[model samples]
Target: MTDQPEPGGRPDAPRLTTREAAELLGVKPETVYAYVSRGQLGSVRAAGGRGSTFDADEVRALARRSGRREPSPAGGDLVFRTGGDLVFRTGITLIEQDRYYFRGVDATELARNHSYEEVAEWLWTGELRPGVRFTAPSETLAAARRTVGALPAHSGSTDRLRVAVTAAAATDPLRFDLSPGAVLSSARSLIPTLVGALPVLGPTEADGGSLARGLWPRLTARPADAPALAVLDAALALLIDHDLAASTLAARVAASARAHPYAVVSAGLGVLEGPLHGAASGLAHRMLQEAVDRGSAVPVVADHLRTGRPVPGLGHRLYRGEDPRARTLFALLEDVPQAAGALAAAREVVATTARHAPLHANIDLALAVLSVSCGMAAEAGETVFAVSRTAGWIAHALEEYGERPLRIRPSGQYTGPRPAQPLPHAP
Candidate 1:
């Protein structure tokens, strides 16, 4: 009467029949088959013409990851996969038809029409405040500066920033408050603190003005100019957020666990080190610098291809055309007279790489042009990226804090030996 295997048969075997697998996973048999077709779960056909069987352990693991227990009030699962990416419901930003938006407004337009602070304020709340300035608290800034100053002399900007944020967190009594007002207050102070903690390399002191103006001196020794500062401001605004990036996902995970806003940012900063994320701009900066030195992008492009490393600063997974951020920044770079040579080098690199594959420039390449022209270090782009994206990470944290606590957990697939195997006696 039961669906179990016949008596004397291996009913409790590691391989399970389709019905047994479905029961364990809490999904319909059809859904289990869908998982197989998607390669999310593997199945083996029984001997001769019998039905397919699945690994019992694998099925349980999938069940734990899927976590598809109850239907929503509308009779559908709250979370579902689309094209192999987890989609989170958010009202903050949207990318559609190759163009991205912030709260339904074109992001590039927002960057162009408003200051970075104004744009960040809009992202945090629906209202926009013109000429807004995020001033750091005296005690927080002093603590961050003291901690950053204590780092090694050759420490990168990102390293100093990480230490600064940790120190700032320790000095704030209300850092644990998750309310919107408190979080926004912390964000305003934290952004300035991160910028203020950096060593000033330029004549333009970070005393008063827009955040971009404050950041300009820290990135380069050159004095700030209108056109150059414009590009930097737009770059900051454009880099604010890209829907659920690797670092943003990490930040969201931390926020879901009720970690303080500072901890969420620290989590994001930890994941921003690798080539695929924040450091990509630094790589692109090096490439552009080499291209300028050689007076041509041909050798640089050839070297990258010969070495089997995909050319950096070109192509984006999300866009079929040129990255919008890159396009905007490139347009802005045209206004900076000092950036002319670097801009030309960037365009040449695009043309050179296009012969092998039709790929367009991404934000990293545009950032490279700026850094190379402004006499900034290669890691300058990484610093700008980190400072610009903190607003976004905090925005995501705000959203995650409102969600169900600890909802981002996903089970890992186990590929080790069977559970009943004897333990090893020696190393």
Candidate 2:
């Protein structure tokens, strides 16, 4: 083993043995020997610690080689070149069937037993309480469009939303040098505000800033039947927090890059807007609605299956059974009959016809039920889910505040033909 005096008279970095390396890499210890034999890893002797040790570079290389692509689950793929696993859960929680890792509390318990602000406080600020601070919706685009007339039509919805929030946060000195407590509070306030402000602004629940209520008119043919607000609020509470999602991961990735609040949130929003990620559920819900309207869920399911596509809202990559979110949301939808029937029929069709399939009915299905029940047009469900998932994005940002800057480097999988001579003849 190669050895030198500790760098700059400082103690040497702790090194791993073949066994230690495997544990650290979440692989068999033999994997270390294989790497060393293949010239992909190095070994060293520890002076200050264990004498038999593996090189840090070798360990990091192994980790990148076996990242999320491996068959391991959420808690498994954790080997890296830098930083300890700071995000491990102390316990799992579920409230109103919504899942959370609250030191040790169940999320369903927290959501059903606690208010939206309480859950927000718990996830972001490390504290929970009833009736947490909430922001008012925007007054800029109130029901009465007061700019004398509609503005020009070229502005994109996504751009308008991002720029508006960025501008709003920029005007506030508080966002800079933000305290964890402050960020959490701002998140609590900004979510509904974003929802309310998306179309207009500065109204609270008392002032009737129910996001679903406000956005309903824009999506549906008629005004909502009132229970929609309850379903939407429940959604905001239930879907607001989770360990990590792809979009949330992207948000955290931006945060790890030390991006400011707007950039981080925008990063998350961008990812969530992707069809394969966070926004998928909302889209799934719309598809379910279409299937239900066809009076038979099986035909819709069959069409998707024939096309080698998935029937959304029925399955999840993580949750094995019905997604806790779907259960929680469906329970909440009991009061909203229109949503409840649609939800039930969708579940039945998926279960009865798609038995061999993985149609587990996730949060998207729940959101769909709530949206239709609330008079939301099928198209707007995805947008609302985006609004809600951003809460989790902010919470992840807060968690990353103490982490080292993002050093997530994935190596290329060199698989193409390495050398290419000139083509002999054009065919």
Candidate 3:
């Protein structure tokens, strides 16, 4: 077969390869295909029909149009629930039969043996190399402490955490490296630094311990007993990843743009501050506290139902029966004296709710109970959640980094009024 000029191509028209077109548009090759599929740009078969070539002028025109204004569909027809459909694919974690599996290993089972660091390393590198450790550099920890300590005493933990992460990113000279090893190193350092820098109720010991044990003193003045520490460790493992949570999606989007690991974590943390996400645990904590004070779980649940608000710790959209994470944690608390009151209240709430509906306790509710049992503050549950889920965010960010860049951009649907025509002025 002989080569020929592209059909309808000008004799001197410039052509661009797929990679060149992607560069011009600041998109991935998959996105370029998306543009072609949507008829936003044109392409022709290459010489000998080997591959496709794009018209440089056409590609440039599309870029200019995109730059001028955001593109939108004709009508506001496209809609997807926040957790409804599978918008993207992931190999990190999966939700099946009301249980979560990380890389095909049962998370609840893994929690029985692995620490948060092991689970995090498994998620990041796809290997569960035993004896692997994650430690923050002395300088990074010092920087984080200085940054967090400067925050106002009344500042929320999340706000202080945000500032600390920003400072950590600014101090790391290798923040721009996007390679896998570099990204993993940054995540390892960032997690430990963040935990160590937070304000603590007591002095933290220098002795080597699990991540949960190290974080215990920071969350409350409660003694770091083995049972309590184990519960916290299991919670951390279970919350490591939940398959494309809102915060995870935000992190992935940031990573798609090649943002540094710290910046990607910051993005995830920003989304997690919302009540519907990370703060759900705080609401559950308050409810449990009220139940304990009132000496009855029925009244508290009844009041919540009467107020037309969903019980904070019960009912999950994805799980039909019960959250396995909640079940695992609740079971662990059954024999602990410190958690006795909180556990009793939780049971009563569960029994009362089951009479009226099919609702069951979720991970947030379990975390709340754990926080109260350990005598932590009302907002302490959210802190645990944010810290634990940082592992998942980093895992998802790494996954997105390996995929096509900028493939998460969503098309908008315009519903606003059309542009107005100019009117002639009278003299």
Q: Pick the candidate with the highest TM-score.
A: 1
State which candidate, 2 or 3, has the greater lDDT: 3
Q: Residue 289 of candidate 1: its Cα lDDT?
A: 98
Score candidate 2 by lDDT: 0.60
TM-score of 3: 0.80
| Candidate 3 worst ten-residue window by lDDT | 75-84
> Which candidate ranks first by lDDT, i.e. highest?
1
Q: Model 2, residue 236: what's the lDDT?
A: 65
Q: List TM-score per model, in order.
A: 0.87, 0.73, 0.80
Comparison by TM-score, 2 against 3, better one: 3
What clash pairs does model 1 have?
none
lDDT of 1 by residue, 282-346 (tens): 99999999999999999999999999988899999889999999999999999999999999999
What is the alpha-carbon lDDT of model 3 when measured against the actual structure? 0.82
Q: Over all chains combined, what TM-score does candidate 2 have? A: 0.73
What C-alpha lDDT does candidate 1 achieve relative to the native structure? 0.89
RMSD of each: 5.4, 6.8, 8.7
**How do the residues 320-352 of candidate 2 rate in per-residue lDDT, one tens digit apiece?**
677776677777777776676687666775686
